[model samples]
Target: MTRDATSFDALYKAEPDPWNYETSAYEAEKYRRCLALLPRCRYPRGLEIGCSIGVMSAEIAQRCDSLLALDFAQTAVARARARGIPNARFEVATIPAEWPAGRWDLIVLSEVLYYLGPAELDRTVTLVAKSLAAGGCCLVAGYTGPTETTLSALDVQDRLLHGLAEAHPRHAIYKDRDASWIAAIFECRTCPAGG
Candidate 1:
């Protein structure tokens, strides 16, 4: 099962910026790497899951014509909305349960999947694959850190690799000197052979 919304709610209640995402240089660098890895310069439609505070979403919004940013925590959602990106929409939604309604050209799964258990991870990955538009891509990024959650970064990446079959996956391992984060992009096979 995915980590309950209550725990996240409690986390935000205790501290608004629980992950230090607002002032972390590490997070800023990861966001840079993520933006660089996207195949297209501009995506017509995009979705960002676990978009805490919308710091990264603000940058992503510039690259997308329409963006939907979701988080299970309402506090996070409110803070994200305050970023005031006109093209982006922020909402409170849990993954694999409160999924969006349409497919997307770019789907971002950043620092969020490791919170889900094996079953939820698998199901969420499957749903991600099913939701990708033709020739679209999904970006999955997470850090290799000690966590209270049930799934690790490796576990989530493994599930993504196995669950999203039939896609051309690209792995961008960000081990800059001593950094510990992995970002992967899976592009759907929308075209036929040689056509």
Candidate 2:
């Protein structure tokens, strides 16, 4: 089953920061872990999908020459944009369909992939493979615990591993069960290896 815009809209309608990402300790630590796991210290260009409220986007912008953060919900995008980070841009765009132009040294799918079905996630993976700069990496983080959503964090990582097999990607898994989240960093091997 596809989780559509309405579900997300209702979420945003209830509260600006529905997930408490701005104040949650779990979220703060997860963001820290994601940043720590990056192979490179700085990325030339980075794209963060589903960057709700720009809480993490602001942090990530510090580590990138340029960053674009996109969310499907307009409220989320608006909240994220309000942060006013100079190096980061926020937009409303649905993934695998309204992708931005140009490749990126880093593409982040944080806590968002479980909202999709298998086929849609497959399309998203394909887009990541095509949009990623050679030797660039895609970092995917998600909550593994029970949720209303159909897919789990483990399911999302499994799809990435099997679907991107042709690209010969290098994978790193990091988990904090207490925080109920897991993240995987996949570095594409299709191009000449570079940091």
Candidate 3:
């Protein structure tokens, strides 16, 4: 099953920096690699799923004309908003159900997909394929370490890549895997109409 908002909210309430996003060297390096993997230096529009407390959102905002960052937990969203990223807007939203309308030039799914159930993951993959603009890119990154969720990090990336292949050609600009994490950047060379 997908991890519920209540559980995430409780986690944030218990610890403002549950994952130490702001202070962890591991996260800092991960974010660095993620930012470096982007094919372009700037994007007109961007979306970041599960932005947590906006540590990465602040960095992404520097490269985007406008960015929309989402987290289901109200507490997490509130914390992200408090960062006051000028070009980024933080909102409370759950994926595959509350996906924002319109195409995105860049969409990032960092350390979030494994929390989803199979069906939710499938739906999310479809949503991503349909919502990406032509020449747009989607970045998927996650911890390869053991997880309590139904899908492993690699499983989530593989399923998303498989589903996207059906909708559009996969042009992987970057892909990397280490003992701790795996990340890939898939570009949509040509999107179907209305995407």
**In candidate 1, which residue pairs clash?**
none
Would you list the C-alpha lDDT of every candidate in the order shown?
0.80, 0.81, 0.90
Candidate 1 stretches greater than 4 Å from native: 167-178, 192-195
Better of 1 and 2 by TM-score: 2
Among all windows of 10 consecutive residues in model 2, the one with the lowest summed lDDT is 169-178
Top-TM-score structure, candidate number: 3
- Put down candidate 3 lDDT per residue, 1-195, tens digits, no spaces: 567999999999999999899999988988888888888899999999999999999988898999999999999999999998889999999998999999999999999999998889999999999988888889999998877788999899999888777787656558876679999988877844676
Best by lDDT: 3
Task: Write candidate 2's Cα lDDT for 122-152 as tens digits.
Answer: 9988887777887777888888788877888
List candidate 3 segments past 4 Å from native.
Answer: 191-195
lDDT of 1 by residue, 1-195 (tens): 356788778888889888788899987888888788777798899999999888999988989999999999888888899888999999999887888988888899888998876777777887887788877778888887677767877778777866765444532222221268787777775753365
Pairs in clash, predicted candidate 3: none
Return the TM-score for candidate 1, rounded to 2 decimals. 0.88
Clashing pairs in 2: none
lDDT ranking from best candidate downward:
3, 2, 1
